[model samples]
Target: MEYTEELLNEFYNPANVGVIKAASAVGKIVDDENGEIMKIYISVEKNKIVDAKFQTYGCVPSIACSSMATKMMIGLTLEEAAASITASAIVKELGGKLSDTKTRSAEMAEKAVKAAVKNYSKK
Candidate 1:
């Protein structure tokens, strides 16, 4: 299978693969059927995402999507983060054209982020 440089880079050097010292919310994935597992931590200040990170174990697409989403949401307000984040957005940021199956990773990343943000908003 052929992969682009963007895919390779994201898969090999994913950003935000650590945990935040203090997070308002943490989204934990406990499903393996999809083979895309991710745990995200979000730090919120004044309803904005001051910081975000995740620990994930999945294929290249999943990793890239998660990494990209984390980066995108870093300084965005919760509303912006929720509105701007999506599987298609991740794919577009990666230059588009991901396999249909691989696209789930992007969706998973979006859900994870939203879940984390929701948890934080509750607190």
Candidate 2:
């Protein structure tokens, strides 16, 4: 199982790797398939994501997925972010394909974003 440079770069220098003290919303998801969990924090204004971050306990693919997903969310509206983030997108951003396990990384990212959005809507 070879990893791409993009994947390694994201895993090593992950972006948005923390919690927001004053976040507008927070979301979390656990991949029961792999015993991994990802929690997302976001600050939204006028339906746009002003900031995003995530904390995850998982593998390199998970980190890369959340990093890229959070970065993508930073400037997008909630709907747009939800529509675009997916497991396939993660693998594509990494410039490679993934097995089923790696694919779950993207799903985790997607779930995190959706969870945050759902929480935000409650406000």
Candidate 3:
């Protein structure tokens, strides 16, 4: 698959690629088919996300999507991030579309964000 320069950049030098030890929320997902796992950590303050990070073990798109998703979440309110961060949004941020097979990576990012918000709400 042909990846955009933006996507390649993110893939090669992903941002927010770590854990937030004191994260307010955390989300994790695994791709059943590929056994790829993605984990997101978010630290929220005053209803806003002060920081976000991710650890993904998968293909290039998975890592890129996770990185971009977390980067996009910073400074966004939890509600806004939850509502605005979608698979399409992640792909868009990555500068274009992903193949059908790789689209799951973006979806994983979306699901992880929602899961993190849900986890936060429960606390």
Candidate 4:
């Protein structure tokens, strides 16, 4: 079985796949041995996620997972942000069944959100 065209398109053409001009928090996760490097950049206002972006140099599923996670977090409150976001959620949202290797991307997304929250909480 191969990744569907729709899935591949989503991965190739991620929605928020850039860096925020002014980021409130930026997080990086890399497991060299595992070959996962996920970086997320986010901008917030009043503790709400106003803008978000991600840059990842990984497989298609990893990229797609992070990209979709960033898309889902936009316009979410700090509290609401924590409640949502998960690898399973991304997989389900993306029509399900991403390669197991890409699972780290979802964890990266969760960590990124937590990193943003931690940054905001410090202020």
Candidate 5:
């Protein structure tokens, strides 16, 4: 899939593209259909996310989505991050030009966030 200029920028210069060594929560999700995988690590303190990072193996859009997802979550509380993560929001944050085909990447990003929250809550 051809990515938009904004997505290309994000993919080429991804933010928070590493694992947090001592993450408070970690989440991974895979897209069997496309062989896409995303893993996110987050550090939370006092109910707030102090750090967020991700490793994505997939298309350009997948990397871009995860990059933005991490950037959006870093300073937010766990609850705020969870609520703010959505496909529509991801697309909007990508400058609102992502096509329908790439929405799965955003969905994957959302699933990763929910997984992190669920994992953190289990502790």
Candidate 6:
């Protein structure tokens, strides 16, 4: 699978690759097929995401997607991020798309964001 330079850059030097100890929202997901895991942490203020971070154990695409998703979510309202942060968007931001086998990576990132929003709503 060929990856764009932008995608490779994200994979090599992923941003927001950590945890927020006092995150306002947190979400996690696991890929049963491969045991890959992704966790997202978000801090919200005035209904907007003030910050975001992630920890992922998976392929390059997964790590890149998670990093891109978190960067995209920051500064967005909870509702906006939940509704707008789709797999396609993450792929696009990463410079087009991922291989068929790695498509789930972007999906996982999307799901994680939605899960974080859901967690915040419950609080």
Best by lDDT: 6
CA lDDT of each candidate?
0.82, 0.87, 0.93, 0.76, 0.89, 0.94
> 43, model 5: CA deviation in Å?
0.3
Q: Lowest-scoring 10 consecutive residues by lDDT in candidate 6?
A: 94-103
Q: What is the C-alpha lDDT profile of model 3 across 34-83, one tens digit per residue?
A: 98999999999999999999999999999999999999999999999999
- Model 1 vs. true fold: TM: 0.91
How do all models score by TM-score? Answer: 0.91, 0.93, 0.97, 0.84, 0.95, 0.97
Screening candidate 3 with a backbone cut-off below 3 angstroms (N, C-alpha, C), the clashing residue pairs are none
Off by over 4 Å in 5: none
Clash totals, every prediction: 0, 0, 0, 0, 0, 0
lDDT of 6 by residue, 61-103 (tens): 9999999999999999999999999999999998896889888
Q: Give residue 54's error in model 3 in angstroms.
A: 0.6
lDDT per residue (tens digit) for residues 1-123 in model 1: 555577678888888889987778897765579666888898888888888998888877778888888999999998888888988887788777787757788888889888887877777
Give per-residue CA lDDT, model 4, range 61-104, as digits (tens). 77877788788888998778767886677777777766665566
Sorting all predicted structures by lDDT, with the top scorer first, yields 6, 3, 5, 2, 1, 4
- Model 3: how far residue 64 lies from native, Å: 0.3
Write one digit per residue (lDDT tens) for candidate 5, span 1-123: 556777888989999988889799998998998999999999999999999999999988889999999988988999998999887788788877777788889999999998998899999
- Model 2 TM: 0.93
Tens digits of per-residue lDDT, candidate 2, 1-123, equal: 877888889999999899999899999998787899999999998899999999999998888888888988899999888888777776788876667646778888888888998899888
The parts of candidate 3 lying over 4 Å away from their true place are none
> RMSD in Å for candidate 1, one decimal?
1.5
Query: Which segments of model 4 are wrong by more than 4 Å?
Result: 4-6
Model 6, C-alpha of 101: deviation from truth (Å): 1.1
Which candidate leads the pack in TM-score?
6
